[model samples]
Target chain A: MDNHLFLPILMPLIGAALAVVAGQRRMLARTIVLLATLANLGYGTWLLWLVDAEGRQATQSGDWAAPFGITLVADGLSALMLIVAALLMLTTLIYSFATLDGDQERFFYYPLLLALLAGVSGAFITGDLFNLYVWFEVMLVASFGLLTLGGSRGQLEGGLKYVVLNLIGSTSFLIGAGLIYGVAGTLNMAHLGERLTTIQEPSLVTAIAGLFLFAFGAKAAIFPLFFWLPTSYHTPPVAVTAIFSGLMTKVGVYSLYRVFGLIFPNELARFAPLILTLAGLTMVIGVIGAVAQTDIRRILSFHIVSQIGYAIMGLGLASVAGLAAGILFIAHVMIVKTALFFIGGAAERIYGTAELKKMGGLAKREPLLATFWLIGILSLAGIPPLSGFFGKLALLQAGVAQQAWLITGVAAGVSILTLFSMLKIWNEVFWKKAYTDVSQLPRVPAGLMIPGAVLALASVALGLGAAPLADYSALAAGQAFDVSGYVVDVCGVAGCDAAATTVRQENTQ
Target chain B: MTLILSLVVGTLFAGAVYLMLRRSVVKLILGLILLSHGVNLLIFLMGDGLRRGEPAFVDSVTGAVSANAADPLIQALILTAIVISFGLITFIMSLAYRANQAVQSDDLDDMTLTDKL
Candidate 1:
């Protein structure tokens, strides 16, 4: 019944509408976007407080009861994601203010950015499957606009692939939804979880599971489905790339976590071994690709694929600890990756190129920028006492506990390869003698640096706060495992004790 | 009825896979369109072959519902899917057109790896 749950979603949509109307007026657009995103961050903080106070929160939209009408549900995981997304959005907006100007900003960038936020928030909060689809479309449409904002040769090329692959993914999602509805006779996620528990058709369920995996896999950029990402993600402007790198793909992972943990737990268990194998391959292959790349942005983009493998590997373990590790790693990756991209943007701004070979000796002149970049890279390489280390530690522990030795080995190997890639960038860009004498390069503005620094700081903060975050992740994982809470929140019903008991036992164990 | 739906899905999948392998971007777009239609129809048919049930709502004056309701929810969902697919198709087509204009070729291979990276 609390109205606070809707603010994070509604405020962004309102802002987007207003910003669109204020298009081309640079100051007005920037002011509206910044105020709106900041407001979203503030409301997100308030929502976090409410979640902390109430344990979990759910709201039925328009006073309609659940199951029949749309419901916005905010549990611990949703709240955490909203907070992360809001923080990233706010910082990315500031970064954009410094990076984009004239025609670019005037062409509705702020409004589209706000729309993207609304879509993401909506996706995180929505309880209905159909509603999830709608939110996805909202996000995708905005992404389409943002990805092609620059309309460069590379942007268009990459954007075409991105759009096509994702269209197929969306189509598959629709087909899967239809099949699930056919079998279960409901589109509400909680109701589906309740009814799907007893389905006797194994093959049919497997087919549906495959569809969901394909749809989400493309979005998350896992293994064979990830070829589009490295090329395409490097094309956008820095702010666009930073936010997309930070939040969008993670939304895919989030959906995977949500669907598999809540509605398709048995299917997930059945498919864990397969997922583990793919994850191992994904990590190894992605990093190898990174190693082959000379371009800084492209290398970083490939790392995103490799890092996603670690998250999926954690999910593949299908254990509470594993899921917890996945959630924690997702948060860490969002922060570290965004910061790295912002640094890349800054480097590009300084050198007029993203090619590592063309750049050298940045540390001598821009020590502060170099320090921020170093922190991001070290954290990305999973240095101990950094956020990345704890994420991997949890995942590796889960892998060992689950007897997934191959996955553990590959995960560790990827970390090494990741270090090699980071060192390559360091040697070429930061430590080597100046190639083009960018000592005269323009100073990176405070606006952009501050956002990157905030994310860099968050990476350290997450590492220091690991214990409490891990506990929270475990609770969210518990909720993920037990469908009864979700079902109760969505359907306002109380009779599904058997499933709840099983979930509780599994989580406790 | 279900068999017919499966046939349509199979054809669509076949066409889509075939088109996806082709080098022409336009053909690929066509393949996607066929795939989308096939998927949309498959989803529509998944509702267990339209029942001989009444439409979702009944008129009080007539005291009767439509003879073949066919799951209005699925139909409505299918309509939404159609709209979404149409939008995607339009966007993809425009992208292809723009790519052709910029690269001066309809074949994807015309854009070399040297230029791409």
Candidate 2:
């Protein structure tokens, strides 16, 4: 059963290679990508079920044992992340099938999408920090291809900022990995966790954690490092933007939760206050930034930054409940944000412009589209009976439990602004009368709206059925914080001692 | 020798940061290449400096390599880093060239087409 764990990482990789080989045959490429995504989704659900029943599993590649060879691990957290990723990949690929132009289809779009999947899935499964860095590069390279496609002046303009910032982010990430290896003498995460607990200096490990935070900070689009996100994210194709907003930044947040909770549990208190401060700032600034944007995609981009604050707030709360809430919030936001982007894309198809100033009458023209969009909007603004409300309530409750008054205030305030801005989009883009001649507007493609409409419906379903997801997240969080169990399971009994000796031997040599 | 090597790595990192901060897109790409070099070197040094030790394969009877020989895993990681960074650098160069072709400028400040409207 442990051996079956590599199948999730392998399937997308095989699928990607085939997709690239079938590049000229557009139908073959799309079909392969669709099948691969469906298979991955199935595999992810199975893996989650297995983990739920059996707990965490680990497998070292090449038949070598742990701490010696590369290991892949899957606990509830990884399984949950994988399923979320596969689900997004499937929905977005379906959306792209109908929406992407012939020009894009002829390009390497399908292959790049699969490659990004491989990278993302690989990052979640790898038990080694250095391997995680490698997977990050894989994702980055694929994104470069996806982002810069079309070569429009705006795309090139946005793509450059995205490229440069992310490259720096990768470099910082590499440096951090190096520092950790130098300190710990092993890059295997379980080994690192074991060694970290025994090490005398909390500050040293915390310092490395800070480096990771900065590196991932740029990726997650946290404040002071978030300029790259709003500047470039609006420039991508709506399908691309949907996937980007949905999965990419959350990967960074996930890593933060993993590394701090797994390898640096002793240092959480030192990091929590700072994380909380950043959380509050990230929320206020992100929402305010959204208010300033006139473009549909741009507003959503800023809100991505703000919603990230709630997830980070969960990290700050630093309790099992808090982390669970963070996990739930991240999952909730991923679907809502992607659905909103899809709706924007669908609306853009009809209105022929992304500028909210120029577009209106969508609600009058397409009430289904408007109503579908309202589920996402209402859910995002923390309304009751919606997914976002439970996410916020959990965070607010977690904050109260932790005595984090400032963040609780920020969360409350941000919800109001969030509703205000979302309503702004509702008024300007959907409900308001058309700005120009109404008959000149293009027809809303029913096919394109279907993907987002389904997702919007799913968001409501998720909201109504939020309890199971919250329970699942709490279970995942339990797995994350139980580092001793992880070290024992991944490395085997007393493998922690064996890993430490190995590190010592490496240093002396 | 270790001191000089580390100094070289530090110089590469410092210079890379300087180049990355420049307004020119090409300069930014060059900075990244240098930064990767610094990182790869840091990782290489992680395996430890030259020490008096024989290859573990000398003891072929037991099939267990001696601990004294440099562990090959860190080097393998470094090689992987080099290849990945090389690909990233090439991609960024092409992306910069494409940006230049599209916008007719290498200056990042001038590459703000989407932000102005």
Candidate 3:
């Protein structure tokens, strides 16, 4: 049963090795990646079902036992993230085919892609802290290859800054994990959570938590630490940028949720104030930067930071409702953001540029593409009956409930700015008359259009089916907010019992 | 002993930071190497100052835990981190080399085409 949890991580890793060995065979590599991603999606659905039916699943690899050996656990939040990642991987693999040329496909694209997918899945499901860091390294290295593969001067420059900043994040993550292990006498996340229940040194734990905040904060691209994102993210090829826009920073956000939500619950009170302040600042700065950008991908890249602010704000609220909102909004942003990038990519392809000024008359040239763009735009703006609406509504409702007046106001303001920039894209890329000599422009291929169309439809369907999604998110949120059950599931009943007794004793005192 | 080790870590970190702030990409890579070494040493010191004299090895016959064994988990962790950082530094070195060759400069300030607002 626990082995079922391993498949999502394993399948991609095995496929990556196989595809790398089958290098230069574009047809074979593409087929391998697409099939592996599809298999992963199916496996993700299965794992979600099992978690839904059986509750959080747990397994300690090699029978070394809990708090001693490596553990893999998947609860509601992990499963939800897993399924979304699988779906994104599947869609983007197909999307890459349409975007990457034959030479690019054979340039280890499929291998690096599968490796990244594996790393992300491994991060989502791992039950140990150090393992999460290891998975992050895996994901980071693959991303570096993909980001710099073209060896263009711009890509190399961008990749340099990216690696420099990311290595700092990685080092901090390792140091944090080490510190936690030393102070808490455990490396297992469940064990750490259990041990931290009655922490005598709250400041020490909070200091470690601050390190994680820096580590994950940089990865998630929050404000004051987000310079690397807009600079480098726009330099990658469209497929690479689109998927990075979707998944990479969210790994940071997810880690933030995990570390704060579970292992450092005792430190949250001391840290929440700083987190809320950062969330507000990240949102304001991200969208304001986006508003000033003229390039389509560059604008979308800035909005990624701003949207991340909303995701973390939920955690900053530190309530069950807030976490549910954060998780829901995270999934919604991942889908909608990917679709927007695809729309931007398609527009860039048509005009042979990402500059909004040079692009126009897409509405006249391609009505279907325009409709897809509108759905993404509307969803991003939180228009009703769209996925983004529910995501924002839940978050806003949570903020109002918490009486977080300032952050909530900033969030609302950012939403308007988001809509305005998105409109700039629509007006310049589609709604306006053709500004360029487009006679030489090729027709927008169905391949490029279909990926965005599918994701755009998913955004709408996510909205239409928001009820079930909200229910799942609420269940996941419950699992995140109170993680004693996760501790028991991973570390066994004995560890949880000891932690519970400590908690009870502390409460009575 | 712990104080002395922490001072070493601090000095390494300071040096790494100073190097990382320079304009040359090679300095940045050197800083990164020092940064990683500083972190690895920090992790070593973080593991409770290495009390035991030998590696933690269980008895073959009785399967009993070694009484005087060190905390091997952190050592394992540092080993893994070393390997990972080794790969990373190589990648960064090559990336820096590539950027230098392509742009005809190693100074980050000169690579301003991608940084425009």
Candidate 4:
């Protein structure tokens, strides 16, 4: 079963290659991507269960000992991310089947999507820091392609900003990895966990941690670094935007959690003030930005930034409960946010535009679209009996427990504003009278509507079944924080001892 | 050797930043390329300064590689980084070309089609 860890990463790559071979046969390529995504979901679920039952499983490539060879690990956190990623891939691909233009389907879109899936899953499970950087590049390259696929004026303009900023972020990550290697002599994360503690220069370690924070923080679209998101996200096809909205920044957030909690647990306290301050700013600023946006995807794009603030708030809380809440918040937002984009994409189709001023009276014509969209936005705003409420409540509870009053206040204020802004969309798009002639709007196909409804219902199920997921998130947090267990599981006791001895010898020399 | 290389890397970074802040998108891509080269060199310096004609093999008796030997891993890393950056820079160049055509201007300030409120 441990061997199956590579399957998630490999399946998509194989699918991508096959899709490339099936070039020009759009049907064949789509079928390949669909089958691959379905297989991945099955594998991801089985892997999650396997990990839950058997504890963290790690596999070293080439049978080389840990710290010397690249390792792929699947603890609770990775398995959970894997499951969510596969779910998003499948749902969005299904939505794209009906919505995506024929030109996009013919232009290696399927291959790029599979390649992106491969990259994201690779980033999630890789145990080496440099390997993570490599996976990030893979993801970025694919994203750069997807962002500018149609090469329209808006797409080219948006893609330039997205590419440059993300490239800089990836370079920062690479620098961080190189410096960590210089300091610890090993790029393997589990080994770094052991060796880093042995290093005497706390300040250097803090600097490296800060570098990582900036790197991952930029990718995650934290405050002061999120300009690329709102500018670029709405320019893509909604299907492209949906997958990116679900997975991209969250990968950055996940890395922050992994790096801070597992590798830099000692320095987390020192960074907490800065992290919490950024989180609060991110929340307020993101919501304020959302309120000012008139485009459907643009408003939702800004909300992605706002939602990331809550996830980071969990990280800043620096406790197991806080981390668990953050994890749950990410899961909840991924499903709900993608659902909203799907519904919004459908709405965009009806009016032939994404501008809210051009769209109105959608409720009367497509009641089902209005219903799914309402579920999406209501959950986004943290209303009761929805996923967002539970996610926000858990975060609030964690904050109150930690006595982080200022950030807690900021979070609460942001939630109200989130509701206000989402309601703004509701008022403009549904309740308001038609901005354009509603008589001539085309029917929104079931293909576009069904995927979103599935995810919206999933959000409801997530809320009603919050207890089990919370428990699982708590479990994942426990595994992430258990650095020694991680090290021992990856590197045998003797291997860890050898690494420790080398550190001692180097220090003395 | 370390000081000289560090200075070179610093210069590359400085030049890159200056170019990146310019109005021309082509200069920005050039800046990005320079920035990547600087980082690659920085990693090389981090791997430990130059060790001419040294082998990376471990001594059988000590079961450890000689400290004086060059780190082979750093070379592999730098190679990977170079290749990745090369691909990215190529893409960014094409993207700039497309954007330039679409907007009919090389000035970064003019490409505000997507940034409007």
Candidate 5:
């Protein structure tokens, strides 16, 4: 039964290796990637069903017993994330196959993409802290390749800064993991969570938590550490950028949710005010950055940072309702952001540029494309009956319950700024008269249109189905808060005993 | 011993930061190298200091744990870090070289803003 959990991570890894061996055969590589992603999506759905039917909180990987070897545990939160990731990956793979040239497909694109999926899956499911760091490296290495895959001047320049900053983040994660192992004498996350509960050194715990915050914060594109994202993400091709925009930072948010809610609950609760402050600042700064941007993709990139603030703010409230909101917000953002980027890509194709100032009156030429863009952009701005609205509504209610009035105000203000930016794009690109006579622009191919429509439809479906989704999210958040289920599932008998002894020793010391 | 090690790490970090802030691409590469080394050493130190003993998990130990063994996991982790950082540095160096050849400058700001307009 636990073996089912390994398929999501292993399938992609095996596919990546196969693609590397297949090398220049673009057709074969594309087929293999598509099949693997579909298989992963199937497996994700199956795991969700099993968890739901059995009322299982988490699964231990293999019969090898947990904590001693490695485990892939999928709780409600992880299952939700896994499903979102698989869907986004499947859609993006289809989009890339239709759009990117054969040469790009052959050279490191498919393999790195598969490796990235493995990394995200592994990060979501792993039960060991050290294994989480390893998976992060796996993801980062693939991302490094993807960012520079174009080898253009802009790509190399932006990719360099991206690599440097992320390397620092990687180092910080490793050092923090090492410190936790030193203090707790275990590398298993479940074991560490149990041990952390007994430790009396509040300052040390805070320092360790701070390190995690920096490491994951950089990955999640939170405020001061987020400079690398807008520059680097904008350098990639739109297909690749869409996946990164949709899935990658959310992996960071996932880890933050995992560690803060499970391993360092007391620390997070104590530092709630600080996190709330950061969340507000990140939102305000990000949208303001978006408002200042003239390029369409750069504006979207800044909005990624701002949306992350909503997820983090949900966690900052440190309530079951708040975390549920955070989970729903993450899912909504992933779908909506991917759709917006697809539209941005299509708009770029039609206009011959992504600069909003240079693009006008696209609606006149391609109403279908404009309709997709309108749905995506409106959903992104958190309009009613959209996925974004329920996420923000849940978060705001949670904040109000906690009396975090300042954060609620900032969240509301950021929503308006987000709407303004989306409207700005609409006015410039879809409403005004064409800046150039682009009627001669070739019609968008059916292949590209289909994927864009699928993602846009997904955004709406996610919004309309918010009631059931929110219930699942709430269950996940509840499990995350009461993480003893995770500890028992991962550490089992012997590992828990060892961890208890270590915790007792630390308390005595 | 911890104080001395901390000072060394701090100095390396300061130098790395200074070079990272510089305009030249090569200096930034050098800075990354220094910073990674500093981080590697820090992780190594976190393994409860250096012990005058053999590595853990000897071949002959079956039923008993080695009481005097040095922590081998940190050592393995450091080695992995070293290898990964090495790959990243090589990639960054080649990227810098490519950027220089294409744009005729090692200044990042020049590359960024010029492309924007």
Candidate 6:
């Protein structure tokens, strides 16, 4: 069962190679990619069940023991992320079938998409910090290709900012990994979990922690470091943008959860105020940016930043409930945001533009799409009996429990702004008089509408069935808080405590 | 040896930041290259400073690695980082070149088609 840990990462890589071999055979490539995603969905479900039934599961590569070889470990958190990612990948691929141009389809689109999935899965499962850096680069490289597939003027411009900023972020991550290895003399996360506690240099560890926070925070698009997200995310093809919106930033958030929650609990507590303040600013600024945007994708792009603040808020709270709320928020946002982009993308396709001024009265022409869009935004705005509402309620409840009144107030205010922004999109794009004759406009194909509907319904289902997910997130958060079980799972039953004692003795000597 | 390497790393980083702040897209790619080099050197320096020793190999006699050999792990890490950065730098170069051609200027300000409010 532990051996199956690598299956999720491996399948996409094999699929990518097969896709490359399929070459100009577009249908074959698409089928290959679809099969890989489905296989991963199966594997992810199984892994989640295994982790839930058992404790954390770990497999070290090539028979090497833990702390020496690369370790792939999936606790509840990793398994949940893997499953959500696979679901999004399948939905995005289906959406792409109708929206992606033949030019892109023929030009290694499926291959690159598979490669991106491989990277994302690897990042989720890897138990080594350096390996996480490698996975990030793999994802970034594939994304660079996808973002600029058509070589359009807007794409190149957007891709440049995306590439440069992310490269810097990756470099920052590399430095952080290198320095942590120097400080703790181990790169494996499980070992670091033990070793970091014994390390004597508190200030140095804190500084390194700051480096990591900046690196992952930049990638996650927190507050001031988020300019690249809105500028570049809106420029990609809607399918490309949709997948990125769903997976990429969440990976950064996941890293924060893994690193701070597991490895540097003390640092996380120390920096809680800073993290909370950043979260507040990110929410306020992001929603304001969204409210100011006229382009459909651009508006959605800014909302991504705003939504990320809520996830980080969960992290900043630093309790089991806080972490669970963060996890739930992440899961909720991943589905709802992607669904919005898919619906927004379809609207963009109908009028052949994303500018809100040019599109109106879509509700009358595409009532079903309008309905799906409403479900998406209402969920996004955290209205009652929706997944977003449960996610936000959990976060707000956690914040109040923690007595983080300022950030809690900020979060409440931001949701109203988020709703206002959604309504602005609604009024301009759906409810208003037609800017042009919509009778002549092409109807949205089933291919596009179905994916959005599926994900929107997923949000509804998640909301309706919130109990199980809430419990699951609590389990994941508990695992994250208690790193001892994780260490034992990865580093044999004897554990690293003996090794840690020896290191401490040597330092004293 | 550690001090000199640290100084070089600092200089490289400073240069990279300076170049990255320039308006030209070409300079941005150059900056990324310099920045990667700086990070590689920093990694190398962070590991046990300059050491003249045998390659990391286990002594069959003792069944343990020779204590004096430079850490092979750090070198392996550097190699991996270098290869990844090399590929990324090449990709960025091409991206910038194409972006330059598309926008008809190397200036970053001119490439605002996507972000214009």
TM-score of each: 0.94, 0.96, 0.97, 0.97, 0.94, 0.97
What's the lDDT for all of these models? 0.85, 0.86, 0.88, 0.91, 0.84, 0.91
lDDT of 5 by residue, A422-459 (tens): 89999998898876887878888776777778888987
Q: How many pairs in model 1 have backbone atoms within 3 A of each other, for residues 3 or more apart or on separate chains, i.e. clashes?
A: 0
- Evaluate model 6: give its TM-score: 0.97
| Pairs that clash in candidate 4 | none
* Higher-ranked by lDDT: 3 or 6: 6
| Ranking of predictions according to DockQ | 6, 4, 3, 2, 5, 1
lDDT of 3 by residue, A405-488 (tens): 998898898899889988999998898888666666789888889889999999999999999999988988888766678887
The worst-scoring run of ten residues by lDDT in candidate 5 chain A lies at A499-508
Ranking by lDDT: 6, 4, 3, 2, 1, 5
lDDT of 1 by residue, B10-116 (tens): 99989998998899998999899899888888877877466654556755665444546567778878888888888878988888888788778888787543235
True contacts kept of each: 0.46, 0.62, 0.67, 0.67, 0.41, 0.73
Q: How close is candidate 1 to the true structure, as a TM-score?
A: 0.94
lDDT of 5 at A332: 90
Please give the DockQ score of every candidate, comma-separated: 0.41, 0.53, 0.54, 0.56, 0.44, 0.59
**Per-residue accuracy of model 1 over A1-509 as CA lDDT, tens digit each:** 87677888889999999888887677887788889888988877777677766766777788765555677888777888898999999889888878886778878888889999999999998888888988898899899999988777777888888898888888788888988988887787787788889887867988998889899899999998998888788888989989999888899899998889888999999999988887888898889998888888888899999999998887899988999999989989999999999987888888888888789988887889889998998899899788999999999999898888888988988898899998999888888998676657888789878999999999999989999889888887877787877887665566344434444444344
Q: Could you tell me which residue pairs clash in candidate 1?
A: none
* Single-chain TM-score of chain A, each candidate: 0.96, 0.96, 0.96, 0.97, 0.96, 0.97
lDDT digits (tens) for residues A1-509 of candidate 6: 26888899899999999999999888898899999999999999998998899879899898676667899999889999999999999999999998888888888999999999999999999999999999999999999999999998989999999988999989999998889888887899989988888889989989989988999999999999999999899877899999999999999999999999878998999999999999999999999998778999999999999999999999999899999999998999999999999999999999998889999999999999999999999999999899999999999999999899999999999999999999998999999999689899998899999999999999999999999999999999999888888888888666665645554444344
Over the true interface, candidate 5 deviates by an RMSD, in Å, of 5.9
> A365, model 6: CA deviation in Å?
1.6
Q: Interface RMSD of every candidate?
A: 9.4, 4.4, 7.1, 4.8, 5.9, 4.9
Could you give the CAPRI-style class of model 6? Answer: medium
**How accurate locally is residue A248 in candidate 5, as Cα lDDT from 0 to 100?**
85
